[model samples]
Target: MAINNDVLSIILGGGQGTRLYPLTESRSKPAVPIAGKYRLVDIPISNCINSDIKRMYVLTQFNSASLNRHIKNTYHFSFFSSAFVDVLAAEQTMQSKSWFQGTADAVRQSMHHFLRHDFEYALILSGDQLYQMDYKLMLKEHIKHGAEISIATIPVNAKEATSFGILKADKENIITSFIEKPDAKLLPDWTSEVSEEMKNEGRNYLASMGIYIFNRQLLIDLMSNPDTNDFGKEIIPNAIHDHKTLSYQFEGYWTDIGNIDSFFEANLGLTDSIPKFNLYDREQRIYTRARMLPTSKVSGTTLDKAVIAEGCIIHAAKIETSVIGIRSRIGKETTVINTYMMGCDKYESLDEINKNKTSILMGIGERCFIKNCIIDKNCRIGDDVRINGGKHLEDKETDQYVIKEGIVVIKKNAVIPKGYVI
Candidate 1:
């Protein structure tokens, strides 16, 4: 593989993912299970690997141990080579600094790290998006156009456009106007630039993918600008006129798995009759840390549009449109639907009373029934327990399980007693 010494990939994986609720209460969004097989962090890391960009760093905070372990196991570089991947955490470099304040601040905090490396461009991306793109092509375009900053923008529906950072690009593809999230009327008329079919195909309004290719020195200079401490809210909008920012029009499978609906939708998208996003391309395989376990086994169970990862045992359970994480056990007569079960990973390094036990490892309780809920890592549920549509009862103040938006959240390393209904 040829090395692109001028580029360094920086992935932002630290967001709290509050909107994803039950799924993110204990772990960061990047570590959240996706399609029952891979973590959200796998998306960007897989993209970088497939794009042939090896030098990468993931910036993370807020329950990052699982995320860090996933990255360490999934992304391994040869010791004989100069190219490598690293995960960066918020650490006190000096007595003055404490933790990353924002995305811009996260990058700003790593100024010293990149300062030692000689890279001409920095490829910044989000860890919580499901998309497949050839970033090498985008980088080539960035260098060819001599762009100070390049943003990955895709057309999204106007009705759903307010959820993203909307932009207005000129005829030459230069970004002229930018808004984090605009009202419907305030959005630019992308119809003229795109086709009606595109709009119908979930494409019309240009939305930022939260992916950027920044001229290294220019980004450093921009970060040094005390007036700006945020990217989408401040620096990006501020760079509209002063910088040669270009919008790279991307039309492909792209979904921001930021909220619960989007997260659930993205997971369900994987089981589409003809999935929009393909992670099984042999030529451009999406790589993740292998669990080194046997493939999942189902005994007299029925699975419909579900994703079951390795080392899982489904015993006569009915699973539909859900994602089951690693090392989980689904008992007979149990039903799981539209839910995300995050299994216990030894990599999480949480203290557990059960050793190498599937139920104890991922925090799932034996014989418990989960439905339309998100069970966080390392939760122990006792036999014959009912999740009740994954709904949580708010009346119990001292109880550990909290429900948000009709989704029940079982925190990491939690223990639910036997026969108890949550």
Candidate 2:
């Protein structure tokens, strides 16, 4: 792809991802693995790359080691080309010796580096979303409208509208008002005026995708304000009244993988006949680290509509409607239904496996019945373990696992003892 040097991409990777809990317990939100082999950071970066926007910076703060490593190893640009993907970790400054307070604040803090480059537009994106987008089209709209900032907006339903920052745009697509999770009673007022097609389809509202292309100087001035910490909460809402902010209407498959339940559903959605976010799109493919591993070997495993990644060794496991990650190891007589096993980083060697056979175990145990659960990376499940959703749990945390939105999540590197049923 030819490089577009007019813009500089800034990805918000500094999020602690508290909602994603144990997944974000060890690493930054962006570092969390997705689908099977790809990291969460890969989605936005890939979008930028595919969009021909070459220069990029990933802002990270909490648990940045793994995120930094992944970026360093996965992305490599030619010396001849000016394209680069860099990580900007939060740091203490003389003027303010504090960490990034919010999304806008993170960009505000990293202004020095971004300003150093000669770019007209600053493309800001969220790290934890599943979609494919061409940002160049957005850039064109920003230029055509003669706007100070161009926000990427998506048509959403009323139920999902409650979670997002809703916006009302005029016939010309100029944003008139911005509401951050408005009251249910006031929803009708905030609902967007869409086309007849969209109205008939039940998409009555427009929500922010947290994607924005800002005029360099406008963003600099906004970030300079001490009160403007978050983009959705303060910055965007105020900008609508003052600046010429246009809504670049985006009609595509976009999901904010905010919590465990949404994440689980998104993963399983890929296993369907026609997934919302098609990962198999060759033209607009989701890029990730190329792991050089042997092909997955499955013996006596009945996989019905499942996406089993590379380097997996499955033995007599009946996986139905699931996403088994790379380098995964499923033992014999295991029935995995509606589960997401984010496979291990490396396979346990024969020596390592033999030494840790008794007390320490790795991978799925025999006769394990894992249904509606997410087994994070490097988890150790012992014999006859059951990860069936014990009860209808909502936003509950535990020592071994967490139940978010009624879906159980076995944390990364956690161990489930022999014959444990939970």
Candidate 3:
């Protein structure tokens, strides 16, 4: 495939990720695991890679070590090639001595590094969205419309419109107005002309996907202003009137992984017979770290609608509607349902396993019944544990786990003792 060397990709690693707490407690939003194997950042990076946008930089501020390591280990281009994916964490320099304030600020702070590179357009993407898009197509549209800036817009229903940055575009797909998370009462006026299929589905409002393309010079010029800290809240809304900003309507599957409830649903949704976000598409392959791990070995486990990754040793009695990540260990007589177990970082050796037999061992132990939960990586879930997460349970947090919107999230590297119940 002929790569788009003219466009440089800039993936924004979101601030704090407080809504996705615990998952983002130790790591940044981009580093959060998804689909049992790949990190959240992998989605946009993979999309860019698959779209032939090779020169990229991932800008992050908080908890960036793991994200940095993942990018360093996963994306490796030839030395001869200019294609590269680099992590640009917030640093105190002569110009600035603070962390990234917002999405635009992150890009602004990293402009010095970006200015060194040669590119015609800047492809700004969110690190935590789940979708497969061809940037080449979007780029072609931007050039066709002679747009200085292009924002990817998706048709969203009225119920969802209030939660997103809604916009109105002209007949020629040129954006005229923008609103940041408008009130439900104002939705009727914000509706854009979507496809017949989208309109039939009651998806009339065009919501910004937080995906944008800015002409190189415009991006650099925008960064010069320190007042604008966010793209959705500031930049796009202001730029629509001044610039020839085109609204590139996308009718593909795209979900903003903003909080725990949405994150949980997105992961579990992959267990569907045919997921909205297709991971099986050969053309749009999701790139990730290549681990030399053995194939999963399941014994006596009756699996149904489960997406189990490599290096798993499952002896569970049954696992339904769940995603078991790489290097996971499920002991005998365990029943896992509607859960996402992030799996272990490293395999527990036979000696270590024997030593921890009396104590809590890595992964879900024997006779456990876990449902509607997110078991973070490297957790030690002891024997006879029962965690049934649902609306019946109120939101609360403990040292070991957190229950938000009734979904139990076992913290990463947490140790749940024997006979524990939630």
Candidate 4:
């Protein structure tokens, strides 16, 4: 089918992002760096672009400056074309003076702006997720089923199902019942008819992917009510019986980057021999900002399963199962394992580097040993610093870093003194 021009995408930027703290301390959740160079927001936007859905609106509230700047710098189209990506920050308006209360309320507050556009459907997506999907296929299924609302569902095991909103679909794939994060005891009754492969893997319950396609009119009618604040918790549950909701089952590499542990694992997972979320797919390309940066220069580094971005100057002793971001500078004899080092924003001048010879400098320092950690952007690690994250360490939060679930997250622009140990 031809590209669907009748749909407008609305990417929801999550609130606070306290779970992914330290990383989200300065920037919004969507603006957090992911998979070496790309930001988290790039995933859904790239998916939309690949599906030929150009126009998109990103709704955000806290720390939206970086997200706004990233979107503006990355997504650009011809002036003659209708393609554009805009950021809508929460504002006090005549209709509503409060901030976005929940997922549904965020769209409701911005409905006026959406109404000005000419579209038949609204594709709502979460900003903090890692997955690639052709939204066109879901749109096609929505139309074929004559669905008022269509939710992308994935078969998840009972352990994982309790964390998401589960849906039970009828023989026609029409959603009949909905429960928001059901109890473990309710798993048997909530199991849906998934494929044989999913069944064999003990993934029988259908969990909502938090991706939805709502008919424009139906969305408008639903938004008129101020009571329904969240889609999964309130709207979906109430509308399942009344509306013709279809569950578009998707079996792919989808993971919700809700917390620090998940985010850390997701980045490290990319260093796998064959990652489930393929970034090398020629057809399903992941788009990001086009920077005019030089190629990375590696010398004497024994790299193993490392994904390094452009403009890096690496001389580390060894880097295994790590994602080194753009403009990173790793000094000699440093060992980074199972870590994500979000590189610097800009290169430090030679003069500046020389002046800081006796002080902490940007990127990993010499003789440092960092393992199972996430070094945020522009971090300076002095020589001989050691951070070994594991279950032995208890969860704690410092001014410069945070240790959650045994994963150390160095805050953005933090400076670790020389010879420091954790």
> What is the per-residue lDDT of model 2 for residues 114-144, given as tens digits with 9 covering 90 to 100?
9889888999999899899999889988898
- Model 2: weakest 10-residue lDDT segment is 387-396
- For model 4, residues 1-422, the per-residue Cα lDDT tens digits are 43557989999998999988988888999999998899999999999999999999999999999999999899989999999999999999999999999999999999999999999999999999999898999999999989999999999999998899999998899999988889999889998888999999999999999999999999999999999999989999999989999999999899999999999999999999999899999989999999999999999999999999999999999999999999999999999999999999999888987887746778988999999999999999989999999999999989889999999999998999999999
2 or 3, which is superior by lDDT? 3
Off by over 4 Å in 1: 1-3, 188-192, 199-202, 346-369, 390-398
Residue 193 of model 2, lDDT score:
73
- C-alpha local distance difference test of each model: 0.75, 0.88, 0.94, 0.94
Better of 1 and 4 by TM-score: 4
Against the true structure, what is each candidate's TM-score? 0.88, 0.96, 0.98, 0.98
Q: Quantify how close model 2 is to the true structure by its C-alpha RMSD in Å.
A: 1.8
Could you tell which candidate, 1 or 3, scores higher by TM-score? 3
Error of 2 at 352 (Å): 1.6
How displaced is residue 104 in candidate 3, in Å? 0.8
lDDT (C-alpha) at residue 152 in model 2: 95
